[model samples]
Target: MIRSAYSHPVAEVEITELSAVPLNVVELLSKAHHPKAGAVVLFSGEVRNNNNGKEVAYLDYEAHQIMAAKMIRTILDDANKKWPLNIAIAQHRTGKVTVGETAVVVITASAHRSEAYQANQYIIDRIKHEALIWKCEYFTDGSHQWGGNCSCH
Candidate 1:
């Protein structure tokens, strides 16, 4: 079953969500802000107009809702262990997402830009590589293919 938003209290991570609706960048960024943070990095993974030379119509994402949310929390926790982050938040969409729309977002705030940037990248990379999410790419010709979110596997 598709789940809306899921969030639970973690020691370092504030939010881990697998949402069915569109992600709000401004709201997430605001939540990542901290008095001690000197930098907050945001990564929005948008659905592009084309992929592998095919004209894309849109994307449909599916995930093992509970498993995916737990995986994201684990990823955030790992990032927290590796960086001195004040806050971290991750949200991923799990439904029809049109071209140019955000499919996933990761925000990290730290006392330095270096840490924030590193942690943000780490979180997204791990999610793309490890999350239990699947993506089906719809082409303009009405063909589609289901696969993992990344090419790592």
Candidate 2:
């Protein structure tokens, strides 16, 4: 269940989304375009080939969909309140994702680069810590481990 606390008119696109398909950065960026926005920032988190000295094979992501979506929306709403943003979107991928594939994308637009950059980072950081999402990493050595999306631990 996506939720927003903003009093302004909402954007045409959903603020937060959890998808099973690969994220399309181009499409998302296009949606963020605004005539008043002088700056647009995009952050894409991709699956790497190695982690903790292990040759990573791929990753499988799972989330409590309703709760995760809600958390992401809240993060975006908080960011909007803190920054003069034109548009903000956060999208996460679910299920198996191969190396080099994007797992999450955050886009933010504003009248200036600083606010856009800061808000983009803030939204992503909060989502990492607050969203109810988990990731399982598969290694080439036939081993696997599961952990929360947050890297803080």
Off by over 4 Å in 2: 1-10, 148-150
- lDDT per residue for candidate 2 within 1-153, as digits (tens), equals 334456654355654479999998898888988888899999999999998788989999999999898788778888888987888899999999999999999998888999999999999888877898888999999999887234767
For model 1, how does the per-residue alpha-carbon lDDT over 31-136 read when each residue is reduced to its tens digit? 7777888898999999988887889899999999999988988888787778877778899999999999999999888888999999999999999889998899
Clashing pairs in 2: none
Instruction: Give the CA lDDT, 0 to 100, for residue 121 in model 2.
Output: 90
- In model 1, the runs with Cα more than 4 Å from the true position are 1-16
User: lDDT of each structure?
Assistant: 0.82, 0.85
lDDT of 1 at 124: 94
| lDDT minimum window of 10 residues, candidate 1 | 1-10
* TM-score leader: 2
